[model samples]
Target: MHGPDVSWYLALSGLMFTIGAIGVLVRRSPLIILLSVEIMLNGANLALIAFARHFGHADGQVFAIAVMAVAASEVVVGLGLIVAMGRRNIELDVDKLRTLRG
Candidate 1:
């Protein structure tokens, strides 16, 4: 299998972002929206790693790692909120959950 070059990785990353964007736009559930946002972050990380490898620079890889840490933290916090919100009801509709928001 061919290793992904910068352009190919960038294209794939852009596609991932687009898919995530659509998911966020079309889904009415908070969990799905959060997952979609994660997809976007992963795409950006992929692009950063790709460019880092291509340029022989450590910065992009370092940034990618940082982004990953952020994404993980986001997932933890978002899921925690989701669980707290879920305890209130079975419905996952974003609109219904808005009432719980301050």
Candidate 2:
């Protein structure tokens, strides 16, 4: 028997990416933005794995792994910046952060 088509996976990925993009654009909190970025990364990962499986190649999965590594680093850096701002007693709001000169 045949399995589900690749388009379904791609559609789901698109939906996820759209939601994440909206969250990133519409939210004001730094933590929320970071979470949105993570969501977008996961969507990309899902697409990559889906395509890899469809093509019967390991490259997509390998790239997904690399993407995951980069995503993790992104989270670490994003959280670090947020923590730094917190330590400095700066507001966590993105609009307020734009005034930061340093």
Candidate 3:
């Protein structure tokens, strides 16, 4: 059956996802990098919602909701750590978070 204009949405989401990934990779600030990761998650969520609306399936929508919840939890925990780092010491640089030190 013929469908809605979902290709554009998918393309836009793809671009957004790529941008977010690139931002995460290229950025030097931990805060910006975390926000970029969130953007990537949101991009995937947008695509899932579009597919759900286009294919008339509730599963994708449900999955999207789950992703959102996970993303929110991640934001809470991740931002708490960032704030903690900021309060305890200066950690504006992404490389400053050297948790995997030997």
Candidate of highest lDDT:
2
TM-score of 2: 0.93
lDDT scores in order:
0.88, 0.93, 0.89
Choose the strongest candidate by TM-score: 2
Q: TM-scores for all candidates?
A: 0.85, 0.93, 0.87
Candidate 3 C-alpha lDDT tens digits along 19-52: 9999999998878988999999989998998899
Clashes of 3: 0
Please count the clashing residue pairs in each candidate, in the order shown. Answer: 0, 0, 0
Assess candidate 2 and give its lDDT: 0.93
Once fitted onto the true fold, the runs of candidate 2 whose alpha carbons sit more than 4 angstroms away are 100-102
Model 2 alpha-carbon miss at residue 58, Å: 1.0
Clashing pairs in 1: none
Give residue 85's lDDT in candidate 3 (0 to 100). 80
Of the two candidates 1 and 2, the one with more favorable lDDT, higher being better, is 2
